[model samples]
Target: MKLIYVFFFFCIINQTYGQQKELELIHNCQGRLSGFATVKVIDKRDSSGKQMIGIVQKGALNKPVKVVFNGELTDSLAAFFIDQSANSNPLPLVLILNELFISEAIDNMTEIGRFRLSLRLFIGKQSDQYSEIVAIDSLYTVKGLDVTKKLLRSISEQFCKISQLAAEKQPILDTDAEKYTFKQLHYLDSLEKMKLPMYQTDHPSVGLYKNYKEFKQNTPGVTAELSIEERKNGFRVYIWDEKRKNKTKLPSTGLYAVSDGTTLLRATPLGFFKILKKGGDFYYWRPQVNKSHHSLVPAAYMYGALGGLVYGLIEAASAGNNKWLLQKINYRKGSAAPVSWTTAKEN
Candidate 1:
């Protein structure tokens, strides 16, 4: 009995020790996002699809906000990033919202009949000089203001999702992070050669949406979208249209490989996931998974989603006439910090 107790105690201690290492890694890697920001929402874009000008609405569209890494600090995974060569903004991060705004020709103006939405994040200090964009999304929307409402409602959840992805892509193995000084422009290029793909599964491996428009063209009014890709070291991406029972390949791997490729957004398999009846974003493969469904999300996504849900519920109960319900949090190029060498370990 004494030996058995000693063995269990050691096991528990080891578990806590591993978590502590991760907590400290990201803390030093991100240096804790400096509190500074501004909000901007573009209403229109030019011929080149560049943001023209936007009016800040009432919601969480403001900045200089406080962002928690999903749950407690202990929840943070040990992740590191390359740092900026030059000193720029303290901690620069930007969130962009894109809309397709498809409309019929009115008397003189265009009215939106169908609208497609896309979300991207820019992380870095000298954004112009060095920055990374992570496209985090699930289903494409064709709804109108519901888009904004849903965006607002799920802002915190999205933020948590983003934060968690950033953390997981962090080196599964502990890295000094300091040694990788001098920002490398083609960090993602290494992914193609990094043995197994970042995401753990075979379908909808992490990256970006290459043929989103193509898939949408084939199946208009897509309620939800689930992307799929093989988990080989090469670039192979695909998105499945559940309604049409179709599979289309993306022209290129979706977005740049952010978060070391373990990003929950990229890790989640493509499928129409039903928000589970248990409340919150808890979803499963009941109606949507008839052997066709891929992985909805990884363990990381579920963790972040829970944080988002907790945040969402609070906002719904308390949100009044406020627009900036979302906190202003962002990351920058070479903004990650180095992990302590002594504590670093191989997963």
Candidate 2:
């Protein structure tokens, strides 16, 4: 019994050590592209159809390798190429590329037999040049042309769906045109200066203004105002007439009002108003407004739907490849083999 207990304890220690080592390896492995090569796509369906070519880069990450496509195509097709470039915001093309390459690497590493690779190809009907994703095996042989073609077709269909949805939910100006009016009284009790109108009652709510005097001095066409008031309930705050004519009313109640100069209003559930002013005229504005149609939830959903469709198209395209080509290459499933090389070439 003593010997058996000792053996079990040793096994547990070894298992824990192995798990820790695996976790460290995965955490430290930075995905880096080591090499890249170009491959041409042959059109078996349409012998005279325009040919597609793309470059595939090898990387350490067990994901689909980067495949860049560029060629003559229509405006819409051309836009996809532009979208692939890095931008201020997240680009759908970049996301798609990342998903395709990452998923491919994962699938390859797992040795999953029933995995699919899709690559969406954007093409213009009038252009001779087209973009595509090229899948190469360990031997650097092309094995994913047919799958890419099918994926492109699916992506085109999904794009049409998203376009239709956008047309239906086109933002309307009147949707945000509701106006609010608030009034308050201010009494001046100072003995120093005789009050012309002993007490002036201006809606404390109206006192709300954006302070942008410094901004106006530094940046042309930039102004801000702030209207503050002491009311019976508490302090009333309003930030009015910023660059975009945005108005925010903060009262003692939990509810807050936010509006653009002319239209577009929002109410928040939070009672506290915190404003962070940055730069000359640019300020980060957060307001509590009514839960209305233009709320963040609806906008997020719209973007998510469109994003999902794009992702789906790219995933579908990654799966396309000519069966003839795959067979000729004798493509076999296996994880990306570890590559080791020194950086002496760079020196």
Most lDDT-accurate candidate:
1
TM-score of 2: 0.18
CA lDDT of each prediction against the hidden true structure: 0.27, 0.24
Candidate 1 Cα deviation (angstroms), residue 180: 22
RMSD of each: 23.4, 26.2
Work out the TM-score per prediction: 0.21, 0.18
Instruction: Summarize candidate 1's per-residue lDDT along 1-347 as a digit string, tens digits.
Output: 44553454344334432231010112332233322232122221112222111111122211011111234221221111222434322444443443222111111111112222344444443323324345543432223432333333343333445544543332212232222211332233233223322122323232232232321122222223444343522234455565758867644323322111222221123421111112111112211111101111221153355433433443354332212110111121101111111211121
Candidate 1, 58: how far from true, in Å?
22
Give me candidate 1's TM-score against the actual structure: 0.21
Candidate 1 regions exceeding 4 Å error are 1-89, 100-117, 140-152, 163-347
Error of 2 at 142 (Å): 20
